[model samples]
Target: MNRKIVEAANIAINNLLPTKSRSLYDIAYNRFKKWCAEKNVQLYSENVFLSYFSENAKNYKSSI
Candidate 1:
């Protein structure tokens, strides 16, 4: 990714949370980025998100 996009993504993620939750959000975002890297997913889209969450959903159980 280009520097501008990377910076924008960082800023966007950081802005999604208050200060205390930033670290946790960062961990999840980094993992998603790493998964994208492993899967050679250079572009972002709704399908990519659906695929990722579908594949990983087994690892997260519902709280209800």
Candidate 2:
């Protein structure tokens, strides 16, 4: 991935997560990337990241 994308992903992950859990953050980040890839969306911006959360938050809650 491009450095900017990686950096953006890191920032997004940090903002979304409550605590500093590296493993959990990694899992979420990877899953976010996979979802973006499958949807042909870029996962390198705040808007896209927020959109993913907005779209999937309910599902995430139900699954937990």
Report every candidate's CA lDDT: 0.93, 0.83
User: Residue 31: error of model 1 in Å?
Assistant: 0.4
Overall local distance difference test of candidate 2: 0.83
Q: Each candidate: how many clashes?
A: 0, 0
Q: TM-scores across all candidates?
A: 0.73, 0.52
List, residue by residue over 1-64, the lDDT tens digit for candidate 1.
Answer: 7999999999997687899988888899899999999999999999999999998898998889
Worst 10 residues of 1 by lDDT: 13-22
In model 1, which runs have C-alpha deviations exceeding 4 angstroms? 1-16
lDDT tens digits by residue: candidate 2, 1-64: 7999999999996777577677787898799888899889953788888888998976767645
Model 2 Cα RMSD, 1 decimal: 7.7
Measured with C-alpha atoms, the lDDT of residue 50 in candidate 2 is 89
Give, for candidate 2, the lowest lDDT window spanning 10 residues.
Answer: 55-64
